[model samples]
Target: MSQKHLTIIDHPLVQHKLTIMRQKDVSTAGFRRLLREISLLLAYEVTRELELTTTRIETPICEMDAPMLEGKKLALISILRAGNGLLDGILEMIPSARVGFVGLYRDPETLQPVQYYNKVPKELDARMTIVVDPMLATGNSLVAAIDLLKQAGAKNLRFLCLLAAPEGVERMRQAHPDVPIFTAALDERLDDHGYIVPGLGDAGDRMFGTK
Candidate 1:
Protein backbone atom coordinates (compact mmCIF):
# COMPACT_ATOMS: atom_id res chain seq x y z
CA MET A 1 0.00 0.00 0.00
CA SER A 2 1.61 3.18 -1.19
CA GLN A 3 0.48 6.63 -0.16
CA LYS A 4 1.76 8.18 -3.43
CA HIS A 5 -1.28 9.17 -5.50
CA LEU A 6 -2.34 10.88 -8.71
CA THR A 7 -0.79 10.32 -12.17
CA ILE A 8 -1.91 12.65 -14.99
CA ILE A 9 -0.57 11.03 -18.16
CA ASP A 10 1.26 13.68 -20.20
CA HIS A 11 2.13 11.41 -23.08
CA PRO A 12 2.11 13.18 -26.42
CA LEU A 13 -0.30 10.72 -27.95
CA VAL A 14 -2.77 11.44 -25.16
CA GLN A 15 -2.20 15.19 -25.27
CA HIS A 16 -2.52 15.62 -29.05
CA LYS A 17 -5.70 13.62 -29.31
CA LEU A 18 -7.11 15.27 -26.23
CA THR A 19 -6.75 18.62 -28.00
CA ILE A 20 -8.75 17.31 -30.92
CA MET A 21 -11.45 16.19 -28.54
CA ARG A 22 -11.77 19.64 -26.99
CA GLN A 23 -12.43 21.28 -30.34
CA LYS A 24 -16.06 22.31 -30.74
CA ASP A 25 -16.07 21.48 -34.44
CA VAL A 26 -15.29 17.82 -33.87
CA SER A 27 -18.24 15.78 -35.15
CA THR A 28 -20.23 13.57 -32.86
CA ALA A 29 -19.05 10.41 -34.54
CA GLY A 30 -15.47 11.58 -34.41
CA PHE A 31 -15.82 12.58 -30.79
CA ARG A 32 -17.40 9.30 -29.85
CA ARG A 33 -14.77 7.33 -31.75
CA LEU A 34 -11.98 9.33 -30.21
CA LEU A 35 -13.40 8.82 -26.77
CA ARG A 36 -13.24 5.08 -27.28
CA GLU A 37 -9.69 5.16 -28.55
CA ILE A 38 -8.67 7.55 -25.81
CA SER A 39 -10.23 5.31 -23.23
CA LEU A 40 -8.22 2.35 -24.55
CA LEU A 41 -5.01 4.33 -24.33
CA LEU A 42 -5.90 5.78 -20.95
CA ALA A 43 -7.05 2.41 -19.73
CA TYR A 44 -3.67 1.00 -20.63
CA GLU A 45 -2.10 3.56 -18.32
CA VAL A 46 -4.52 2.93 -15.48
CA THR A 47 -3.93 -0.81 -15.52
CA ARG A 48 -0.19 -0.39 -15.11
CA GLU A 49 -0.28 -0.84 -11.35
CA LEU A 50 -2.95 -3.52 -11.37
CA GLU A 51 -2.31 -6.11 -8.69
CA LEU A 52 -1.06 -9.19 -10.48
CA THR A 53 0.19 -12.40 -8.97
CA THR A 54 3.04 -14.51 -10.27
CA THR A 55 1.73 -17.43 -12.24
CA ARG A 56 3.38 -20.31 -14.06
CA ILE A 57 2.27 -21.02 -17.61
CA GLU A 58 3.93 -23.45 -20.01
CA THR A 59 5.02 -21.90 -23.27
CA PRO A 60 4.03 -23.49 -26.57
CA ILE A 61 7.62 -23.63 -27.82
CA CYS A 62 9.36 -24.70 -24.61
CA GLU A 63 8.72 -26.26 -21.22
CA MET A 64 9.40 -22.98 -19.42
CA ASP A 65 6.60 -21.20 -17.60
CA ALA A 66 5.87 -17.48 -17.25
CA PRO A 67 3.76 -15.19 -15.15
CA MET A 68 0.30 -14.40 -16.42
CA LEU A 69 -2.62 -12.46 -15.05
CA GLU A 70 -4.88 -14.51 -12.84
CA GLY A 71 -8.68 -14.46 -12.74
CA LYS A 72 -11.26 -13.04 -15.12
CA LYS A 73 -13.22 -11.43 -12.32
CA LEU A 74 -12.09 -7.86 -12.85
CA ALA A 75 -14.95 -5.43 -12.39
CA LEU A 76 -15.11 -2.63 -14.91
CA ILE A 77 -17.79 -0.29 -13.59
CA SER A 78 -19.01 2.32 -16.01
CA ILE A 79 -20.63 5.55 -14.90
CA LEU A 80 -23.26 5.81 -17.57
CA ARG A 81 -23.95 7.03 -20.13
CA ALA A 82 -20.77 8.71 -21.37
CA GLY A 83 -18.85 6.05 -19.59
CA ASN A 84 -20.45 3.51 -21.87
CA GLY A 85 -18.19 4.73 -24.64
CA LEU A 86 -15.13 4.00 -22.53
CA LEU A 87 -16.52 0.69 -21.35
CA ASP A 88 -16.84 -0.57 -24.91
CA GLY A 89 -13.19 -0.02 -25.70
CA ILE A 90 -11.90 -1.56 -22.52
CA LEU A 91 -14.12 -4.58 -22.98
CA GLU A 92 -12.58 -5.09 -26.38
CA MET A 93 -9.19 -5.44 -24.74
CA ILE A 94 -10.28 -7.51 -21.75
CA PRO A 95 -13.28 -9.45 -22.93
CA SER A 96 -13.18 -11.91 -20.06
CA ALA A 97 -13.45 -9.19 -17.41
CA ARG A 98 -16.78 -8.85 -15.66
CA VAL A 99 -18.83 -5.72 -16.29
CA GLY A 100 -20.90 -3.46 -14.04
CA PHE A 101 -22.83 -0.25 -14.35
CA VAL A 102 -23.44 2.72 -12.09
CA GLY A 103 -26.00 5.17 -13.43
CA LEU A 104 -26.27 8.45 -11.56
CA TYR A 105 -27.65 11.94 -12.14
CA ARG A 106 -27.27 15.17 -10.26
CA ASP A 107 -30.09 16.64 -8.22
CA PRO A 108 -30.50 20.20 -9.48
CA GLU A 109 -31.21 21.65 -6.07
CA THR A 110 -28.62 19.78 -4.04
CA LEU A 111 -26.16 19.04 -6.86
CA GLN A 112 -25.81 15.57 -5.41
CA PRO A 113 -25.54 12.44 -7.50
CA VAL A 114 -28.60 10.22 -7.28
CA GLN A 115 -28.06 6.61 -8.15
CA TYR A 116 -30.75 5.28 -10.40
CA TYR A 117 -29.00 2.03 -11.21
CA ASN A 118 -26.22 -0.09 -9.72
CA LYS A 119 -25.45 -3.75 -10.36
CA VAL A 120 -21.95 -4.79 -9.45
CA PRO A 121 -20.43 -8.25 -9.38
CA LYS A 122 -21.10 -10.20 -6.19
CA GLU A 123 -17.40 -11.02 -5.59
CA LEU A 124 -16.41 -7.38 -5.89
CA ASP A 125 -14.09 -7.75 -2.89
CA ALA A 126 -11.92 -10.35 -4.58
CA ARG A 127 -11.69 -8.50 -7.86
CA MET A 128 -9.96 -5.30 -8.84
CA THR A 129 -12.36 -2.56 -9.97
CA ILE A 130 -11.96 0.06 -12.64
CA VAL A 131 -14.38 3.01 -12.81
CA VAL A 132 -14.67 4.72 -16.18
CA ASP A 133 -16.12 8.09 -17.20
CA PRO A 134 -15.40 10.64 -19.92
CA MET A 135 -15.04 13.69 -17.74
CA LEU A 136 -14.56 14.53 -14.08
CA ALA A 137 -15.94 18.02 -13.48
CA THR A 138 -17.02 18.55 -9.89
CA GLY A 139 -16.54 14.83 -9.14
CA ASN A 140 -20.06 14.45 -7.71
CA SER A 141 -20.76 11.27 -9.61
CA LEU A 142 -17.19 9.97 -9.33
CA VAL A 143 -17.20 10.29 -5.56
CA ALA A 144 -20.61 8.70 -5.31
CA ALA A 145 -19.47 5.87 -7.54
CA ILE A 146 -16.44 5.27 -5.35
CA ASP A 147 -18.58 5.30 -2.24
CA LEU A 148 -20.94 2.76 -3.73
CA LEU A 149 -18.09 0.47 -4.83
CA LYS A 150 -16.52 0.65 -1.41
CA GLN A 151 -19.81 -0.41 0.05
CA ALA A 152 -19.69 -3.43 -2.23
CA GLY A 153 -16.30 -4.37 -0.70
CA ALA A 154 -14.15 -3.18 -3.58
CA LYS A 155 -10.91 -2.27 -1.86
CA ASN A 156 -8.67 -1.99 -4.93
CA LEU A 157 -10.22 0.68 -7.12
CA ARG A 158 -8.95 2.77 -10.01
CA PHE A 159 -10.72 5.69 -11.69
CA LEU A 160 -10.17 6.38 -15.41
CA CYS A 161 -11.45 9.33 -17.43
CA LEU A 162 -10.70 11.17 -20.67
CA LEU A 163 -10.59 14.67 -19.22
CA ALA A 164 -10.48 15.93 -15.65
CA ALA A 165 -10.74 19.34 -14.06
CA PRO A 166 -8.57 20.49 -11.20
CA GLU A 167 -11.55 20.94 -8.95
CA GLY A 168 -12.60 17.37 -9.55
CA VAL A 169 -9.08 16.05 -8.97
CA GLU A 170 -8.79 17.91 -5.66
CA ARG A 171 -12.22 16.79 -4.53
CA MET A 172 -11.50 13.17 -5.44
CA ARG A 173 -8.14 13.29 -3.65
CA GLN A 174 -9.84 14.52 -0.54
CA ALA A 175 -12.53 11.88 -0.77
CA HIS A 176 -10.71 8.88 -2.29
CA PRO A 177 -7.04 9.42 -1.71
CA ASP A 178 -6.46 5.70 -1.73
CA VAL A 179 -7.84 5.20 -5.23
CA PRO A 180 -5.55 6.01 -8.14
CA ILE A 181 -6.81 8.23 -10.99
CA PHE A 182 -5.79 8.01 -14.65
CA THR A 183 -6.83 10.68 -17.13
CA ALA A 184 -5.85 11.87 -20.61
CA ALA A 185 -5.59 15.53 -19.72
CA LEU A 186 -6.16 17.79 -16.71
CA ASP A 187 -7.88 21.03 -17.62
CA GLU A 188 -7.55 24.36 -15.83
CA ARG A 189 -10.80 24.37 -13.88
CA LEU A 190 -14.49 23.75 -13.93
CA ASP A 191 -16.93 26.25 -15.37
CA ASP A 192 -19.65 28.00 -13.35
CA HIS A 193 -22.25 25.48 -14.40
CA GLY A 194 -20.04 22.59 -13.20
CA TYR A 195 -18.86 21.62 -16.67
CA ILE A 196 -15.17 21.20 -17.32
CA VAL A 197 -13.60 24.35 -18.78
CA PRO A 198 -12.86 23.90 -22.47
CA GLY A 199 -14.76 20.64 -22.20
CA LEU A 200 -16.62 18.99 -25.07
CA GLY A 201 -19.97 19.56 -23.30
CA ASP A 202 -22.51 17.05 -21.99
CA ALA A 203 -20.69 13.85 -22.96
CA GLY A 204 -23.82 11.75 -23.21
CA ASP A 205 -25.45 14.28 -25.50
CA ARG A 206 -22.33 14.72 -27.56
CA MET A 207 -21.90 10.99 -27.92
CA PHE A 208 -25.51 10.24 -28.85
CA GLY A 209 -26.71 13.60 -30.23
CA THR A 210 -29.70 13.47 -27.90
CA LYS A 211 -31.27 16.28 -25.91
Candidate 2:
Protein backbone atom coordinates (compact mmCIF):
# COMPACT_ATOMS: atom_id res chain seq x y z
CA MET A 1 0.00 0.00 0.00
CA SER A 2 1.31 3.42 -0.87
CA GLN A 3 0.21 6.90 0.17
CA LYS A 4 -2.85 6.20 -1.92
CA HIS A 5 -3.95 3.74 0.74
CA LEU A 6 -3.75 6.39 3.44
CA THR A 7 -6.39 9.07 3.93
CA ILE A 8 -5.50 12.11 5.93
CA ILE A 9 -8.77 13.70 6.95
CA ASP A 10 -8.04 17.42 6.67
CA HIS A 11 -11.43 18.43 7.94
CA PRO A 12 -11.09 21.70 9.83
CA LEU A 13 -13.24 20.65 12.75
CA VAL A 14 -11.34 17.40 13.22
CA GLN A 15 -8.04 19.22 13.07
CA HIS A 16 -9.17 21.86 15.53
CA LYS A 17 -10.32 19.33 18.07
CA LEU A 18 -7.18 17.28 17.56
CA THR A 19 -4.98 20.32 18.12
CA ILE A 20 -6.64 21.02 21.46
CA MET A 21 -6.41 17.41 22.47
CA ARG A 22 -2.68 17.40 21.72
CA GLN A 23 -1.87 20.06 24.25
CA LYS A 24 -0.02 19.02 27.40
CA ASP A 25 -2.39 20.83 29.75
CA VAL A 26 -5.60 19.38 28.43
CA SER A 27 -7.64 17.75 31.15
CA THR A 28 -8.48 14.08 30.93
CA ALA A 29 -12.18 14.82 30.71
CA GLY A 30 -11.50 17.44 28.04
CA PHE A 31 -9.31 15.06 26.12
CA ARG A 32 -11.95 12.35 26.26
CA ARG A 33 -14.61 14.77 25.11
CA LEU A 34 -12.49 15.95 22.22
CA LEU A 35 -11.74 12.40 21.15
CA ARG A 36 -15.43 11.58 21.04
CA GLU A 37 -16.19 14.73 19.07
CA ILE A 38 -13.39 14.16 16.59
CA SER A 39 -14.33 10.52 16.20
CA LEU A 40 -17.77 11.58 15.00
CA LEU A 41 -16.16 13.64 12.27
CA LEU A 42 -13.75 10.86 11.36
CA ALA A 43 -16.68 8.46 11.21
CA TYR A 44 -18.06 10.52 8.35
CA GLU A 45 -14.83 10.16 6.40
CA VAL A 46 -14.34 6.46 7.13
CA THR A 47 -17.84 5.42 6.07
CA ARG A 48 -18.10 7.67 3.02
CA GLU A 49 -17.97 4.79 0.57
CA LEU A 50 -20.52 2.52 2.21
CA GLU A 51 -22.68 0.86 -0.37
CA LEU A 52 -26.10 2.41 -0.74
CA THR A 53 -29.27 1.25 -2.44
CA THR A 54 -32.69 2.64 -3.02
CA THR A 55 -35.79 1.04 -1.55
CA ARG A 56 -39.45 1.61 -2.28
CA ILE A 57 -41.20 3.59 0.41
CA GLU A 58 -44.50 5.47 0.71
CA THR A 59 -43.90 9.06 1.54
CA PRO A 60 -46.31 11.53 3.09
CA ILE A 61 -47.85 12.29 -0.30
CA CYS A 62 -46.71 9.53 -2.68
CA GLU A 63 -44.66 6.44 -3.19
CA MET A 64 -40.92 6.97 -3.69
CA ASP A 65 -37.54 5.26 -3.59
CA ALA A 66 -35.36 6.29 -0.67
CA PRO A 67 -31.67 5.60 -0.29
CA MET A 68 -30.53 3.39 2.54
CA LEU A 69 -27.46 1.46 3.57
CA GLU A 70 -27.09 -1.75 1.65
CA GLY A 71 -25.94 -5.24 2.65
CA LYS A 72 -25.15 -6.45 6.17
CA LYS A 73 -24.74 -4.12 9.14
CA LEU A 74 -21.26 -2.60 9.57
CA ALA A 75 -18.88 -4.14 12.08
CA LEU A 76 -16.95 -1.86 14.46
CA ILE A 77 -13.99 -3.61 16.06
CA SER A 78 -12.20 -1.76 18.83
CA ILE A 79 -8.58 -2.60 19.63
CA LEU A 80 -9.29 -2.34 23.31
CA ARG A 81 -8.86 0.37 25.92
CA ALA A 82 -7.69 3.31 23.81
CA GLY A 83 -9.75 2.18 20.88
CA ASN A 84 -12.82 2.52 23.02
CA GLY A 85 -12.55 6.29 22.87
CA LEU A 86 -12.95 6.32 19.11
CA LEU A 87 -15.57 3.57 19.29
CA ASP A 88 -17.94 5.58 21.45
CA GLY A 89 -18.53 8.34 18.91
CA ILE A 90 -18.67 6.08 15.88
CA LEU A 91 -21.31 4.00 17.62
CA GLU A 92 -23.37 7.09 18.15
CA MET A 93 -23.22 7.78 14.44
CA ILE A 94 -23.99 4.20 13.42
CA PRO A 95 -25.96 2.76 16.27
CA SER A 96 -26.97 -0.35 14.38
CA ALA A 97 -23.36 -1.32 13.62
CA ARG A 98 -22.26 -4.60 15.18
CA VAL A 99 -19.49 -4.31 17.77
CA GLY A 100 -16.42 -6.42 18.63
CA PHE A 101 -13.28 -6.18 20.74
CA VAL A 102 -9.68 -7.39 20.43
CA GLY A 103 -7.51 -6.79 23.47
CA LEU A 104 -3.75 -6.38 23.00
CA TYR A 105 -1.04 -4.81 25.11
CA ARG A 106 2.50 -3.81 24.20
CA ASP A 107 5.37 -5.51 25.95
CA PRO A 108 7.59 -2.75 27.35
CA GLU A 109 10.87 -4.41 26.46
CA THR A 110 10.08 -5.61 22.97
CA LEU A 111 7.38 -3.06 22.03
CA GLN A 112 5.46 -5.94 20.49
CA PRO A 113 1.82 -6.78 20.93
CA VAL A 114 0.57 -9.37 23.42
CA GLN A 115 -2.95 -10.57 22.96
CA TYR A 116 -5.09 -11.27 25.97
CA TYR A 117 -8.70 -11.38 24.75
CA ASN A 118 -10.57 -11.68 21.49
CA LYS A 119 -14.31 -11.45 20.87
CA VAL A 120 -15.67 -10.56 17.45
CA PRO A 121 -19.05 -10.71 15.81
CA LYS A 122 -19.92 -13.65 13.60
CA GLU A 123 -20.51 -13.48 9.82
CA LEU A 124 -17.67 -11.00 9.50
CA ASP A 125 -17.20 -12.19 5.97
CA ALA A 126 -20.51 -10.56 5.07
CA ARG A 127 -20.07 -7.25 6.87
CA MET A 128 -17.83 -4.25 6.28
CA THR A 129 -15.57 -4.15 9.32
CA ILE A 130 -13.97 -0.99 10.62
CA VAL A 131 -11.21 -1.21 13.25
CA VAL A 132 -10.88 1.83 15.50
CA ASP A 133 -7.91 2.96 17.59
CA PRO A 134 -6.65 6.41 18.56
CA MET A 135 -3.03 5.91 17.62
CA LEU A 136 -1.25 4.06 14.86
CA ALA A 137 2.22 4.19 16.37
CA THR A 138 4.27 1.01 16.15
CA GLY A 139 1.34 -0.72 14.40
CA ASN A 140 2.28 -4.05 16.00
CA SER A 141 -0.93 -4.41 17.98
CA LEU A 142 -3.09 -3.27 15.12
CA VAL A 143 -1.48 -5.70 12.72
CA ALA A 144 -1.98 -8.55 15.15
CA ALA A 145 -5.60 -7.59 15.75
CA ILE A 146 -6.39 -7.41 12.07
CA ASP A 147 -4.65 -10.71 11.53
CA LEU A 148 -7.03 -12.28 14.01
CA LEU A 149 -10.03 -10.62 12.41
CA LYS A 150 -9.04 -11.84 8.96
CA GLN A 151 -8.49 -15.34 10.28
CA ALA A 152 -12.01 -15.24 11.68
CA GLY A 153 -13.44 -14.49 8.20
CA ALA A 154 -13.44 -10.72 7.98
CA LYS A 155 -12.92 -9.78 4.35
CA ASN A 156 -13.62 -6.07 4.14
CA LEU A 157 -11.69 -3.92 6.61
CA ARG A 158 -10.70 -0.32 7.32
CA PHE A 159 -8.59 1.28 10.06
CA LEU A 160 -9.50 4.53 11.82
CA CYS A 161 -7.27 6.52 14.16
CA LEU A 162 -6.63 9.99 15.51
CA LEU A 163 -2.96 10.14 14.64
CA ALA A 164 -0.49 8.11 12.60
CA ALA A 165 3.28 7.98 12.22
CA PRO A 166 5.12 7.17 9.01
CA GLU A 167 6.59 4.04 10.51
CA GLY A 168 3.23 2.68 11.57
CA VAL A 169 1.62 3.50 8.22
CA GLU A 170 4.41 1.73 6.40
CA ARG A 171 4.15 -1.25 8.69
CA MET A 172 0.43 -1.48 8.03
CA ARG A 173 0.95 -1.05 4.31
CA GLN A 174 3.40 -3.89 4.24
CA ALA A 175 1.28 -6.17 6.40
CA HIS A 176 -2.25 -5.29 5.24
CA PRO A 177 -1.95 -3.56 1.93
CA ASP A 178 -5.56 -4.12 1.00
CA VAL A 179 -6.95 -2.26 3.97
CA PRO A 180 -7.25 1.55 3.78
CA ILE A 181 -6.18 3.73 6.72
CA PHE A 182 -7.97 6.90 7.82
CA THR A 183 -6.43 9.29 10.31
CA ALA A 184 -6.81 12.87 11.49
CA ALA A 185 -3.15 13.77 11.04
CA LEU A 186 0.12 12.21 9.91
CA ASP A 187 2.73 13.30 12.41
CA GLU A 188 6.52 13.52 11.97
CA ARG A 189 7.73 10.10 13.17
CA LEU A 190 7.74 7.65 15.98
CA ASP A 191 10.26 8.12 18.82
CA ASP A 192 12.64 5.41 19.93
CA HIS A 193 10.20 4.20 22.59
CA GLY A 194 7.57 3.64 19.87
CA TYR A 195 5.58 6.73 20.69
CA ILE A 196 4.40 9.10 17.99
CA VAL A 197 6.38 12.34 18.26
CA PRO A 198 4.26 15.43 18.97
CA GLY A 199 1.44 13.01 19.88
CA LEU A 200 -0.78 13.90 22.84
CA GLY A 201 0.79 11.13 24.90
CA ASP A 202 -0.60 7.67 25.55
CA ALA A 203 -4.21 7.86 24.41
CA GLY A 204 -5.26 5.26 26.95
CA ASP A 205 -3.68 7.27 29.70
CA ARG A 206 -4.99 10.62 28.47
CA MET A 207 -8.51 9.34 28.05
CA PHE A 208 -8.59 7.46 31.34
CA GLY A 209 -6.33 9.70 33.47
CA THR A 210 -3.89 6.90 34.23
CA LYS A 211 -0.11 6.95 34.54
Per-residue lDDT of candidate 2, residues 92-131 (tens digit):
9999999999999999999999999999999999999999
**Against the true structure, what is each candidate's TM-score?**
0.92, 0.98
State the displacement of the C-alpha of residue 186, model 1, in Å, after optimal TM-score superposition: 1.2
Q: How would you encode candidate 1's per-residue C-alpha lDDT over 54-161 as one tens digit per residue?
A: 656567776655556776568899998889999999988888888999999977677689999999888888888999998898988899999999999998899888
* Candidate 2 accuracy as TM-score: 0.98
lDDT of every predicted structure (CA atoms): 0.84, 0.95
lDDT of 2 at 25: 96
Candidate 2 has its poorest 10 consecutive residues by lDDT at 1-10
Q: What lDDT, from 0 to 1, does candidate 2 have?
A: 0.95
